[model samples]
Target: MFKQLIPIALIAVCTPALAAEPMVVQVKRLSLDTALKIAQGSIAACREKGIQIGVTVVDRDGTVQVTLRDTIAAPITVPISEQKARTAVNFNAATSAMKDRANSPIGRIDGLVMSAGGVPILVGGSALAGGVGVSGAPAGETDEECALAGVAKVQEDLDLAM
Candidate 1:
Protein backbone atom coordinates (compact mmCIF):
# COMPACT_ATOMS: atom_id res chain seq x y z
CA MET A 1 0.00 0.00 0.00
CA PHE A 2 2.85 2.38 0.85
CA LYS A 3 4.66 1.68 -2.47
CA GLN A 4 1.43 2.17 -4.42
CA LEU A 5 0.84 5.52 -2.64
CA ILE A 6 4.40 6.65 -3.46
CA PRO A 7 3.90 5.93 -7.17
CA ILE A 8 0.59 7.83 -7.19
CA ALA A 9 2.22 10.86 -5.60
CA LEU A 10 5.07 10.82 -8.12
CA ILE A 11 2.66 10.56 -11.02
CA ALA A 12 0.65 13.52 -9.74
CA VAL A 13 3.79 15.61 -9.32
CA CYS A 14 5.08 14.78 -12.81
CA THR A 15 1.74 15.17 -14.60
CA PRO A 16 1.76 18.97 -14.57
CA ALA A 17 5.39 19.11 -15.72
CA LEU A 18 4.61 16.89 -18.67
CA ALA A 19 1.63 18.97 -19.68
CA ALA A 20 1.90 20.91 -22.95
CA GLU A 21 2.35 24.67 -22.96
CA PRO A 22 -0.63 26.81 -23.86
CA MET A 23 -0.67 27.65 -27.55
CA VAL A 24 -0.03 31.29 -28.37
CA VAL A 25 -1.28 32.56 -31.66
CA GLN A 26 0.70 35.47 -33.04
CA VAL A 27 -1.40 38.32 -34.39
CA LYS A 28 -0.23 40.23 -37.47
CA ARG A 29 0.80 43.82 -36.87
CA LEU A 30 -0.68 46.70 -38.85
CA SER A 31 1.70 49.44 -39.85
CA LEU A 32 1.15 52.94 -38.50
CA ASP A 33 0.46 54.33 -41.98
CA THR A 34 -2.12 51.65 -42.68
CA ALA A 35 -3.79 52.29 -39.36
CA LEU A 36 -4.05 55.99 -40.22
CA LYS A 37 -5.51 55.17 -43.61
CA ILE A 38 -8.15 53.01 -42.01
CA ALA A 39 -9.09 55.85 -39.67
CA GLN A 40 -9.26 58.24 -42.59
CA GLY A 41 -11.54 55.93 -44.52
CA SER A 42 -13.86 55.78 -41.57
CA ILE A 43 -13.96 59.56 -41.42
CA ALA A 44 -14.67 59.79 -45.13
CA ALA A 45 -17.53 57.35 -44.79
CA CYS A 46 -19.04 59.44 -42.01
CA ARG A 47 -18.57 62.60 -44.00
CA GLU A 48 -20.36 61.08 -46.97
CA LYS A 49 -23.27 60.44 -44.65
CA GLY A 50 -23.21 64.12 -43.61
CA ILE A 51 -22.01 63.19 -40.17
CA GLN A 52 -19.18 64.98 -38.46
CA ILE A 53 -17.32 62.34 -36.53
CA GLY A 54 -14.19 61.53 -34.61
CA VAL A 55 -12.28 58.45 -35.66
CA THR A 56 -9.79 56.48 -33.60
CA VAL A 57 -7.83 53.32 -34.27
CA VAL A 58 -6.10 51.17 -31.72
CA ASP A 59 -3.81 48.14 -31.86
CA ARG A 60 -4.75 44.63 -30.80
CA ASP A 61 -3.45 45.39 -27.31
CA GLY A 62 -5.77 48.38 -27.06
CA THR A 63 -3.08 50.98 -27.68
CA VAL A 64 -3.95 53.98 -29.82
CA GLN A 65 -2.92 53.63 -33.45
CA VAL A 66 -4.26 56.80 -35.00
CA THR A 67 -6.70 59.44 -33.84
CA LEU A 68 -8.55 61.78 -36.20
CA ARG A 69 -10.91 64.28 -34.63
CA ASP A 70 -12.79 66.37 -37.11
CA THR A 71 -12.73 70.12 -36.57
CA ILE A 72 -16.50 70.29 -36.15
CA ALA A 73 -16.78 67.17 -34.04
CA ALA A 74 -18.08 67.35 -30.52
CA PRO A 75 -15.37 67.40 -27.84
CA ILE A 76 -16.94 64.39 -26.16
CA THR A 77 -16.73 62.55 -29.45
CA VAL A 78 -12.96 62.32 -29.10
CA PRO A 79 -12.93 60.29 -25.94
CA ILE A 80 -15.96 58.37 -27.01
CA SER A 81 -14.17 57.31 -30.18
CA GLU A 82 -11.14 56.28 -28.18
CA GLN A 83 -13.34 54.39 -25.75
CA LYS A 84 -15.06 52.57 -28.58
CA ALA A 85 -11.73 51.70 -30.17
CA ARG A 86 -10.37 50.45 -26.89
CA THR A 87 -13.54 48.49 -26.27
CA ALA A 88 -13.21 46.72 -29.61
CA VAL A 89 -9.55 45.78 -29.14
CA ASN A 90 -9.97 44.72 -25.55
CA PHE A 91 -13.04 42.64 -26.21
CA ASN A 92 -11.83 41.32 -29.59
CA ALA A 93 -15.28 42.06 -31.03
CA ALA A 94 -17.06 44.86 -32.81
CA THR A 95 -18.40 47.72 -30.73
CA SER A 96 -21.93 46.70 -31.66
CA ALA A 97 -21.35 43.32 -30.10
CA MET A 98 -19.89 44.98 -27.07
CA LYS A 99 -22.99 47.13 -26.80
CA ASP A 100 -25.23 44.11 -27.00
CA ARG A 101 -23.22 42.43 -24.28
CA ALA A 102 -23.07 45.63 -22.25
CA ASN A 103 -26.76 45.31 -21.60
CA SER A 104 -25.99 42.01 -19.93
CA PRO A 105 -25.09 41.70 -16.25
CA ILE A 106 -21.51 40.62 -16.97
CA GLY A 107 -20.85 43.71 -19.10
CA ARG A 108 -21.31 45.98 -16.13
CA ILE A 109 -17.71 45.51 -15.12
CA ASP A 110 -15.78 48.68 -14.33
CA GLY A 111 -13.88 49.23 -17.59
CA LEU A 112 -16.22 48.04 -20.32
CA VAL A 113 -18.06 50.30 -22.82
CA MET A 114 -20.69 48.92 -25.17
CA SER A 115 -21.30 51.76 -27.57
CA ALA A 116 -21.09 51.33 -31.35
CA GLY A 117 -18.40 52.54 -33.81
CA GLY A 118 -15.73 50.05 -32.83
CA VAL A 119 -14.59 47.25 -35.14
CA PRO A 120 -11.85 44.67 -34.79
CA ILE A 121 -9.06 44.21 -37.38
CA LEU A 122 -8.92 40.58 -38.26
CA VAL A 123 -6.69 38.53 -40.59
CA GLY A 124 -7.07 34.89 -41.45
CA GLY A 125 -9.72 34.51 -38.77
CA SER A 126 -7.23 35.82 -36.22
CA ALA A 127 -7.59 39.17 -34.49
CA LEU A 128 -4.23 40.50 -35.65
CA ALA A 129 -4.94 44.19 -35.37
CA GLY A 130 -7.49 46.70 -34.12
CA GLY A 131 -9.97 48.90 -36.00
CA VAL A 132 -11.64 52.16 -36.68
CA GLY A 133 -14.10 53.84 -34.34
CA VAL A 134 -16.47 56.66 -35.28
CA SER A 135 -18.29 58.97 -32.92
CA GLY A 136 -20.25 62.24 -32.97
CA ALA A 137 -22.92 60.47 -34.97
CA PRO A 138 -26.57 60.35 -33.94
CA ALA A 139 -27.02 56.59 -33.76
CA GLY A 140 -24.98 53.47 -33.12
CA GLU A 141 -25.91 52.07 -36.49
CA THR A 142 -24.64 55.19 -38.20
CA ASP A 143 -21.38 54.92 -36.34
CA GLU A 144 -21.13 51.23 -37.14
CA GLU A 145 -21.71 51.86 -40.81
CA CYS A 146 -18.84 54.30 -40.91
CA ALA A 147 -16.56 51.95 -39.01
CA LEU A 148 -17.38 49.04 -41.27
CA ALA A 149 -16.76 51.20 -44.29
CA GLY A 150 -13.36 52.10 -42.92
CA VAL A 151 -12.53 48.43 -42.43
CA ALA A 152 -13.59 47.78 -45.98
CA LYS A 153 -11.22 50.44 -47.20
CA VAL A 154 -8.34 48.82 -45.41
CA GLN A 155 -9.31 45.47 -46.81
CA GLU A 156 -9.47 46.90 -50.31
CA ASP A 157 -6.29 48.89 -49.98
CA LEU A 158 -4.25 45.93 -48.91
CA ASP A 159 -6.21 43.42 -50.94
CA LEU A 160 -5.92 41.36 -47.83
CA ALA A 161 -5.22 37.72 -48.58
CA MET A 162 -7.68 36.59 -45.96
Candidate 2:
Protein backbone atom coordinates (compact mmCIF):
# COMPACT_ATOMS: atom_id res chain seq x y z
CA MET A 1 0.00 0.00 0.00
CA PHE A 2 2.85 2.44 0.79
CA LYS A 3 4.59 1.74 -2.56
CA GLN A 4 1.39 2.46 -4.49
CA LEU A 5 0.86 5.70 -2.55
CA ILE A 6 4.42 6.89 -3.27
CA PRO A 7 3.92 6.48 -7.03
CA ILE A 8 0.65 8.41 -6.85
CA ALA A 9 2.28 11.25 -4.93
CA LEU A 10 5.14 11.49 -7.39
CA ILE A 11 2.77 11.80 -10.32
CA ALA A 12 0.72 14.44 -8.54
CA VAL A 13 3.78 16.61 -7.91
CA CYS A 14 5.29 16.23 -11.40
CA THR A 15 2.22 16.49 -13.63
CA PRO A 16 1.22 20.09 -12.97
CA ALA A 17 4.82 21.34 -13.06
CA LEU A 18 5.49 19.65 -16.38
CA ALA A 19 2.27 21.02 -17.85
CA ALA A 20 3.11 24.54 -16.70
CA GLU A 21 6.43 24.67 -18.54
CA PRO A 22 6.49 26.30 -21.92
CA MET A 23 8.11 24.53 -24.88
CA VAL A 24 11.45 26.03 -25.81
CA VAL A 25 13.69 25.96 -28.85
CA GLN A 26 17.40 26.73 -28.91
CA VAL A 27 18.18 29.49 -31.37
CA LYS A 28 21.82 29.79 -32.36
CA ARG A 29 22.08 32.89 -34.47
CA LEU A 30 20.39 36.00 -35.83
CA SER A 31 18.42 35.85 -39.07
CA LEU A 32 19.84 37.55 -42.17
CA ASP A 33 17.47 40.50 -41.86
CA THR A 34 18.38 40.93 -38.23
CA ALA A 35 22.04 40.80 -39.10
CA LEU A 36 21.61 43.50 -41.73
CA LYS A 37 19.71 45.65 -39.30
CA ILE A 38 22.56 45.31 -36.86
CA ALA A 39 25.01 46.47 -39.47
CA GLN A 40 22.80 49.42 -40.30
CA GLY A 41 22.64 50.45 -36.68
CA SER A 42 26.41 50.34 -36.39
CA ILE A 43 26.76 52.45 -39.47
CA ALA A 44 24.29 54.95 -38.10
CA ALA A 45 26.23 55.29 -34.88
CA CYS A 46 29.47 55.82 -36.77
CA ARG A 47 27.83 58.41 -38.98
CA GLU A 48 26.44 60.24 -35.97
CA LYS A 49 29.94 60.51 -34.59
CA GLY A 50 31.12 62.18 -37.79
CA ILE A 51 33.45 59.29 -38.36
CA GLN A 52 33.82 58.14 -41.93
CA ILE A 53 33.99 54.46 -41.08
CA GLY A 54 33.76 51.32 -43.10
CA VAL A 55 31.75 48.61 -41.41
CA THR A 56 31.68 44.92 -42.10
CA VAL A 57 29.47 42.23 -40.57
CA VAL A 58 30.06 38.55 -41.04
CA ASP A 59 28.52 35.26 -39.95
CA ARG A 60 30.25 32.91 -37.55
CA ASP A 61 32.12 31.48 -40.51
CA GLY A 62 33.39 34.96 -41.43
CA THR A 63 30.96 35.28 -44.29
CA VAL A 64 29.83 38.79 -45.04
CA GLN A 65 26.24 39.65 -44.21
CA VAL A 66 26.08 43.39 -44.77
CA THR A 67 28.90 45.82 -45.46
CA LEU A 68 28.74 49.59 -45.59
CA ARG A 69 31.29 52.33 -46.16
CA ASP A 70 30.80 55.98 -45.51
CA THR A 71 31.01 58.05 -48.66
CA ILE A 72 34.28 59.66 -47.62
CA ALA A 73 35.87 56.51 -46.20
CA ALA A 74 38.88 55.02 -47.92
CA PRO A 75 38.30 51.97 -50.10
CA ILE A 76 41.13 49.99 -48.50
CA THR A 77 39.37 50.21 -45.15
CA VAL A 78 36.83 47.69 -46.41
CA PRO A 79 38.88 44.48 -46.72
CA ILE A 80 41.06 45.18 -43.69
CA SER A 81 38.06 45.92 -41.52
CA GLU A 82 36.38 42.74 -42.73
CA GLN A 83 39.47 40.79 -41.82
CA LYS A 84 39.41 42.31 -38.36
CA ALA A 85 35.76 41.30 -37.84
CA ARG A 86 36.49 37.82 -39.15
CA THR A 87 39.47 37.39 -36.88
CA ALA A 88 37.44 38.41 -33.84
CA VAL A 89 34.58 36.03 -34.64
CA ASN A 90 36.93 33.14 -35.33
CA PHE A 91 38.71 33.63 -32.01
CA ASN A 92 35.73 34.61 -29.86
CA ALA A 93 37.50 37.76 -28.66
CA ALA A 94 37.78 41.38 -29.64
CA THR A 95 40.02 41.93 -32.64
CA SER A 96 41.73 44.79 -30.87
CA ALA A 97 42.66 42.52 -27.99
CA MET A 98 43.96 39.91 -30.33
CA LYS A 99 45.89 42.49 -32.28
CA ASP A 100 47.50 43.79 -29.10
CA ARG A 101 48.65 40.29 -28.30
CA ALA A 102 49.82 39.86 -31.87
CA ASN A 103 52.04 42.88 -31.42
CA SER A 104 53.93 41.04 -28.69
CA PRO A 105 56.69 38.53 -29.35
CA ILE A 106 54.40 35.69 -28.31
CA GLY A 107 51.79 37.16 -30.62
CA ARG A 108 54.31 37.13 -33.42
CA ILE A 109 54.90 33.50 -32.67
CA ASP A 110 51.15 33.03 -33.00
CA GLY A 111 51.10 35.29 -36.10
CA LEU A 112 48.08 37.37 -35.12
CA VAL A 113 47.36 41.06 -35.71
CA MET A 114 47.06 43.18 -32.59
CA SER A 115 44.97 46.05 -33.81
CA ALA A 116 41.71 47.57 -32.70
CA GLY A 117 38.25 46.75 -34.10
CA GLY A 118 36.59 43.36 -34.47
CA VAL A 119 34.22 41.78 -31.97
CA PRO A 120 32.68 38.33 -31.70
CA ILE A 121 28.97 37.69 -32.00
CA LEU A 122 27.81 35.37 -29.28
CA VAL A 123 24.33 34.11 -28.37
CA GLY A 124 23.78 32.10 -25.22
CA GLY A 125 27.54 32.17 -24.77
CA SER A 126 27.96 30.49 -28.11
CA ALA A 127 29.38 32.14 -31.22
CA LEU A 128 26.33 32.38 -33.45
CA ALA A 129 27.59 34.98 -35.88
CA GLY A 130 30.50 37.20 -36.73
CA GLY A 131 30.83 40.78 -35.49
CA VAL A 132 31.21 44.18 -37.00
CA GLY A 133 34.51 45.91 -37.80
CA VAL A 134 35.04 49.59 -38.39
CA SER A 135 38.02 51.26 -39.99
CA GLY A 136 39.03 54.64 -41.44
CA ALA A 137 38.27 56.31 -38.16
CA PRO A 138 40.74 58.51 -36.27
CA ALA A 139 42.53 55.64 -34.61
CA GLY A 140 42.34 51.89 -34.12
CA GLU A 141 40.58 52.38 -30.81
CA THR A 142 38.09 54.64 -32.52
CA ASP A 143 37.43 51.86 -35.00
CA GLU A 144 36.86 49.45 -32.15
CA GLU A 145 34.48 51.85 -30.41
CA CYS A 146 32.29 52.12 -33.47
CA ALA A 147 32.42 48.37 -33.95
CA LEU A 148 31.28 47.91 -30.37
CA ALA A 149 28.43 50.32 -30.95
CA GLY A 150 27.35 48.20 -33.88
CA VAL A 151 27.54 45.05 -31.78
CA ALA A 152 25.47 46.62 -29.03
CA LYS A 153 22.85 47.80 -31.50
CA VAL A 154 22.38 44.29 -32.84
CA GLN A 155 22.34 42.76 -29.39
CA GLU A 156 19.57 45.12 -28.39
CA ASP A 157 17.60 44.38 -31.55
CA LEU A 158 17.84 40.67 -30.82
CA ASP A 159 16.75 41.25 -27.23
CA LEU A 160 20.03 39.87 -25.99
CA ALA A 161 21.64 41.33 -22.92
CA MET A 162 25.18 40.73 -24.12
Candidate 3:
Protein backbone atom coordinates (compact mmCIF):
# COMPACT_ATOMS: atom_id res chain seq x y z
CA MET A 1 0.00 0.00 0.00
CA PHE A 2 2.83 2.40 0.86
CA LYS A 3 4.58 1.62 -2.42
CA GLN A 4 1.36 2.28 -4.32
CA LEU A 5 0.97 5.64 -2.55
CA ILE A 6 4.54 6.58 -3.37
CA PRO A 7 4.03 5.91 -7.08
CA ILE A 8 0.82 7.99 -7.11
CA ALA A 9 2.47 10.87 -5.29
CA LEU A 10 5.45 10.82 -7.71
CA ILE A 11 3.12 10.85 -10.71
CA ALA A 12 1.21 13.83 -9.32
CA VAL A 13 4.40 15.71 -8.57
CA CYS A 14 5.86 15.14 -12.04
CA THR A 15 2.68 15.71 -14.02
CA PRO A 16 3.09 19.48 -13.98
CA ALA A 17 6.69 19.26 -15.12
CA LEU A 18 5.73 16.96 -17.98
CA ALA A 19 2.91 19.17 -19.12
CA ALA A 20 3.41 21.04 -22.39
CA GLU A 21 4.60 24.58 -22.18
CA PRO A 22 2.43 27.47 -23.25
CA MET A 23 1.26 27.15 -26.81
CA VAL A 24 1.28 30.90 -27.26
CA VAL A 25 3.87 33.50 -26.46
CA GLN A 26 3.56 37.20 -25.89
CA VAL A 27 5.07 39.32 -28.66
CA LYS A 28 5.65 43.05 -28.85
CA ARG A 29 3.65 44.82 -31.52
CA LEU A 30 3.89 48.27 -33.11
CA SER A 31 0.99 50.54 -32.36
CA LEU A 32 -0.91 52.51 -34.99
CA ASP A 33 -0.10 55.82 -33.33
CA THR A 34 3.57 55.03 -33.26
CA ALA A 35 3.48 53.92 -36.88
CA LEU A 36 1.85 57.17 -37.90
CA LYS A 37 4.42 59.12 -35.98
CA ILE A 38 7.23 57.31 -37.78
CA ALA A 39 5.69 57.95 -41.17
CA GLN A 40 5.16 61.62 -40.45
CA GLY A 41 8.69 61.99 -39.19
CA SER A 42 10.11 60.43 -42.32
CA ILE A 43 8.08 62.72 -44.53
CA ALA A 44 9.11 65.73 -42.51
CA ALA A 45 12.75 64.86 -42.89
CA CYS A 46 12.42 64.53 -46.63
CA ARG A 47 10.43 67.72 -46.87
CA GLU A 48 13.29 69.55 -45.19
CA LYS A 49 15.45 68.56 -48.12
CA GLY A 50 12.91 69.85 -50.62
CA ILE A 51 12.17 66.32 -51.68
CA GLN A 52 8.62 65.18 -52.12
CA ILE A 53 8.54 61.66 -50.76
CA GLY A 54 6.48 58.68 -49.84
CA VAL A 55 6.97 56.83 -46.57
CA THR A 56 5.79 53.45 -45.38
CA VAL A 57 5.99 51.88 -41.94
CA VAL A 58 5.60 48.16 -41.54
CA ASP A 59 5.46 45.86 -38.55
CA ARG A 60 7.90 43.06 -37.85
CA ASP A 61 5.78 40.74 -39.93
CA GLY A 62 6.17 42.97 -42.99
CA THR A 63 2.61 44.16 -42.72
CA VAL A 64 2.00 47.78 -43.62
CA GLN A 65 0.98 49.92 -40.70
CA VAL A 66 1.00 53.39 -42.16
CA THR A 67 1.80 54.84 -45.56
CA LEU A 68 2.13 58.51 -46.41
CA ARG A 69 2.91 60.19 -49.68
CA ASP A 70 3.44 63.87 -50.24
CA THR A 71 1.00 65.44 -52.68
CA ILE A 72 3.69 66.00 -55.30
CA ALA A 73 5.39 62.67 -54.86
CA ALA A 74 5.26 60.38 -57.81
CA PRO A 75 2.58 57.71 -57.69
CA ILE A 76 5.22 55.03 -58.19
CA THR A 77 6.82 55.95 -54.89
CA VAL A 78 3.98 54.43 -52.88
CA PRO A 79 4.55 50.85 -53.98
CA ILE A 80 8.29 51.27 -53.89
CA SER A 81 8.14 52.54 -50.33
CA GLU A 82 6.07 49.55 -49.25
CA GLN A 83 8.44 47.14 -50.92
CA LYS A 84 11.39 48.77 -49.24
CA ALA A 85 9.77 48.52 -45.83
CA ARG A 86 8.87 44.87 -46.43
CA THR A 87 12.40 44.15 -47.51
CA ALA A 88 13.85 45.68 -44.36
CA VAL A 89 11.56 43.70 -42.09
CA ASN A 90 12.02 40.49 -44.05
CA PHE A 91 15.82 40.71 -43.99
CA ASN A 92 15.99 42.14 -40.47
CA ALA A 93 18.56 44.69 -41.66
CA ALA A 94 18.74 48.07 -43.26
CA THR A 95 18.31 47.94 -47.02
CA SER A 96 21.51 49.93 -47.43
CA ALA A 97 23.49 47.09 -45.87
CA MET A 98 21.99 44.67 -48.37
CA LYS A 99 22.66 46.70 -51.53
CA ASP A 100 25.22 44.15 -52.69
CA ARG A 101 22.49 41.58 -52.72
CA ALA A 102 20.40 43.57 -55.17
CA ASN A 103 21.47 41.53 -58.19
CA SER A 104 21.49 38.26 -56.29
CA PRO A 105 18.75 35.64 -56.46
CA ILE A 106 17.57 36.57 -52.99
CA GLY A 107 16.91 40.08 -54.18
CA ARG A 108 14.98 38.78 -57.14
CA ILE A 109 12.35 37.57 -54.76
CA ASP A 110 9.18 39.61 -55.21
CA GLY A 111 8.60 42.39 -52.70
CA LEU A 112 12.23 42.38 -51.52
CA VAL A 113 13.73 45.69 -52.51
CA MET A 114 17.43 45.50 -51.72
CA SER A 115 17.90 49.23 -51.88
CA ALA A 116 19.24 51.76 -49.40
CA GLY A 117 15.93 53.36 -48.55
CA GLY A 118 14.80 50.85 -45.99
CA VAL A 119 15.66 50.99 -42.28
CA PRO A 120 14.73 48.67 -39.47
CA ILE A 121 13.19 50.01 -36.29
CA LEU A 122 14.72 48.25 -33.31
CA VAL A 123 13.52 48.41 -29.75
CA GLY A 124 15.68 48.02 -26.64
CA GLY A 125 18.63 47.88 -29.00
CA SER A 126 17.84 44.30 -29.95
CA ALA A 127 14.15 43.71 -30.38
CA LEU A 128 12.92 44.21 -33.95
CA ALA A 129 9.95 46.51 -33.73
CA GLY A 130 9.35 47.27 -37.37
CA GLY A 131 10.76 49.03 -40.44
CA VAL A 132 10.51 52.32 -42.27
CA GLY A 133 10.95 52.95 -45.98
CA VAL A 134 11.19 56.23 -47.81
CA SER A 135 11.02 56.87 -51.54
CA GLY A 136 11.25 59.75 -54.05
CA ALA A 137 14.55 61.13 -52.77
CA PRO A 138 17.23 61.74 -55.39
CA ALA A 139 19.43 59.09 -53.79
CA GLY A 140 18.71 55.93 -51.89
CA GLU A 141 21.06 57.09 -49.15
CA THR A 142 18.98 60.19 -48.66
CA ASP A 143 15.86 58.07 -48.40
CA GLU A 144 17.58 55.91 -45.81
CA GLU A 145 18.51 58.98 -43.82
CA CYS A 146 14.89 60.04 -43.75
CA ALA A 147 13.88 56.59 -42.58
CA LEU A 148 16.47 56.75 -39.82
CA ALA A 149 15.15 60.10 -38.73
CA GLY A 150 11.68 58.63 -38.53
CA VAL A 151 12.93 55.77 -36.37
CA ALA A 152 14.81 58.20 -34.20
CA LYS A 153 11.61 60.14 -33.54
CA VAL A 154 10.32 57.43 -31.27
CA GLN A 155 13.58 55.78 -30.35
CA GLU A 156 13.63 57.13 -26.82
CA ASP A 157 10.14 55.88 -26.20
CA LEU A 158 11.07 52.48 -27.53
CA ASP A 159 14.16 52.24 -25.38
CA LEU A 160 12.32 53.35 -22.28
CA ALA A 161 9.61 50.79 -22.84
CA MET A 162 12.21 48.12 -22.66
Q: Pick the candidate with the highest TM-score.
A: 3
Model 3 weakest 10-residue run by lDDT? 18-27
Tens digit per residue, CA lDDT, model 1, 1-162: 898899899999998876755568555777898888888888899899889999888888878889998879898887788888888878788878766678788677654568877878776556457766788899988998998888887775454554
The stretch of ten residues in a row with the least summed lDDT in candidate 1 is 153-162
Candidate 3: tens digits of C-alpha lDDT, residues 1-162:
898899899999998987757868777989999999999999999999999999999999999999999999999999999999999998889999999999999989988899899988999988998999999999999999999999899999988987
Q: For each candidate, what is the lDDT?
A: 0.80, 0.74, 0.93
- Tell me each candidate's TM-score: 0.78, 0.71, 0.87
Off by over 4 Å in 2: 1-27, 104-113, 159-162
Clashing pairs in 1: none
On lDDT, the leading prediction is 3
Query: Compared to the true structure, candidate 2 yields what TM-score?
Result: 0.71
lDDT of 3: 0.93
What 10-residue stretch in candidate 2 is worst by lDDT? 105-114
- Tell me model 1's lDDT, rounded to 2 decimals: 0.80
Question: Tens digit of lDDT per residue, candidate 2, span 19-90?
Answer: 898799554555778777766766777788887878888887778888888888899888877877777776
TM-score of 1: 0.78
Q: Over 4 Å off in model 1, which ranges?
A: 1-26, 156-162
